[model samples]
Target: MRILIVSWEYPPVVVGGLGRHVHHLATELAAQGHDIVMLTRRPTGTDAVSHPTTDTRVDGVRIIATAEDPPEFEFGRDMMAWTLAMGHSFVRTGLRVLAGERNTPEQQPWVPDVVHAHDWLVAHPAIALAEFFDVPLVSTIHATEAGRHSGWVSGPTNRQVHSVEWWLATESDSLITCSASMRDEVTRLFGPDLPDVSVIHNGIDIRTWPFAPRPVRSGPPELLFAGRLEYEKGVQDLLAALPRIRRTHPGTTLTVAGTGTQQEWLVEQTRRHRVTKAVRFLGAVDHQGLVGLMHRCAAIVLPSRYEPFGIVALEAAATGAPLVVSTAGGLGEAVTDTTTGLTFDPGDVAGIATAVRAALGDSAAAATRAARARDRLTEEFSWSEVAERTAGVYLAAKRRVRHPVGRPSIPERPLPERDPGQSD
Candidate 1:
């Protein structure tokens, strides 16, 4: 199979788990004897004049990293304009590649059997390229704007993003989600007439995250929270539970290893909770550093209030870290209560404290659960299994009739469609 995977981010430029997901998936697919081409962007403010497109190959996948257009556009601040610029660049690069403009003896022009897009950010380019090439378009909805807002499209930007998400869902031949919970969410949000929705749980290859279990643990008892400091990530809830956790187990501290829009707010929160001294905020630690923290910490906590599928949970579990996670969204499916690790309800500060205390107080049980979680990784969450399932989705997508690419024929909502000719 020849697969063209489009995403806004890739490795060395990861904002969240989506980039990691795509990176592993593309590499694994290429290893399975399939030709894979990854289309992504260079980081912000990169020189598009000197080098418009960069071609590189790593671990069997051919990656084409395109630079952002000139006349500077910041991502979050310039949302819609930036997206349009990126789509135009993608179209240009895809056309050049297909036309053999940069063909050499070593690298020949290629056409993909299927075009798989990661999220709504690259929807326009993916839809256009798939239509132009007459190949099946498969969309994976990593997360939705409405889902992030707890089912409310609050502002204009949020509503626009939601519309684009709906457009991607409507335009693709088949839909894929990281978890069954996410699949259900897609069906509920994108609704009555969607192409077959498939659930392909995210996978992790533990071989990469090598860890030697700590012999003599250093410093105070540490709990690790390694994800974006966002409201949905539930990091604030973890801070709220810190006082109670320290009550039962004195001098217990937390190590946060990520940054986000809520970093300043979360910092303020630690002060208000009066556990400021106990909490150490290490914003955005590298992967190796995070794995080391996982190995050293008493427990790895992922208190996600709206996780599509917590891949970090898999990473932490792979390091033999005792898992303490909230049973929200796919976290419920990922971490089995008591078997793999301890589980709690989302936003339940008390449950978090209790779970953490248990993991800390009972060393033997925590170690046992940690071992169980590590063992479970090989059987359930291997990248090989995920790649195979995704290949199956590609085959199924190829069999279906492709949807026409344009403004959707269906009604658009959350913000009603405006009259084409009437002036506001």
Candidate 2:
């Protein structure tokens, strides 16, 4: 199938997990004998529009990037202005791709078999292109504002984000989510009209993250936490757990990775606990260094308040590091208790310490679990499997669009029971 993917971020310029997700998906699709073209917003480069891009060919698939250049608009510090700019850029790019596809003859058609878009950031373009080309559209909702806030308050910004999500779910032919839990979130937030949401769990490229012999910790057992440090991420809770954790295992050290707004609070928490020396604040390590550290660590911990699907856990699991994650959103789906890794309540500092200590205490057992983790990643979370499932969703979407003449339109019915981590 000739698939056109519209995303906001790509490799070497990732704002969040979405970028890496799209990157691996496209690569895997190419490997499966599908032609893939990516339409994404250019960071800040003034160069050729249809230039050679990342991992363009795999197996029989051909991939390319169609960069969108939006004229700079002064928002004057208004949040709405930023939203408008994003919308305009997406809409304009979608229109451009559609027009180009239409101009070409059917014998050598540029029109895509399916238009698959990654989030609200690229939804405008995806919707616009589908309308212009009259092609089926599939949208993947990664996370929602409600999920982010955890129901504290639904402010205007939150509403705007929700509004865009609603528009995409209503406009697209099919909806895909990372977890069954997310499928429920979509139905609850966007109403039951979403034509049977599908769950396509997130996956990692296990091959790229090659395992090497890790260095024995000359000093203390190293523990690593990577991601945006925030209240929702439960980094502060991890710090609170650290003091208790050290009393039991004094040789253990915690390494906090990634940067976010909660840096000050985390720093203060370390000071308040007086375990600043034990906690190494390694803010924002890149892909290579982070994976390398994972291989050598006692365990990789993620104490998130809520996670749609934790990709970091998969990486750590793939590298054979003992995994410890919070029972947040879809994270529970990723890490198996006492098999691949351990889990604790997002808010329970004591529980987190217990899980962490348990993972580190049984060195032989952890090694066994680590081996199982790497094996599980290969059996379940490979990119090839992810791409095939995504392709099936696109095919189903196309089938729905083609057979819309006689039969009753498939009413977007919400699932009877909430299924977390349910992807097509």
Tell me, by lDDT, which candidate is best.
1
Count the clashes in each prediction.
Answer: 0, 15
- The RMSD of every model to the true structure, in order and in angstroms, is 5.3, 6.6
Worst 10 residues of 2 by lDDT: 415-424
Candidate 2 — which residues are off by over 4 angstroms? Answer: 44-80, 101-109, 213-218, 398-424
Weakest lDDT window of 10 consecutive positions for candidate 1: 415-424
lDDT of 1 at 393: 92
Stretches > 4 Å off in candidate 1: 100-109, 214-220, 399-424
Judge candidate 1 at residue 297 and give its lDDT. 90
Instruction: Provide the TM-score for each candidate, comma-separated.
Output: 0.92, 0.85
Tens digits of per-residue lDDT, candidate 2, 135-237, equal 8999999987667766422345556666777777777788899988888888887765567689888888887777654456566688899898766788888
Best by TM-score: 1
Candidate 1, residue 149: how far the Cα is off, in Å? 1.2
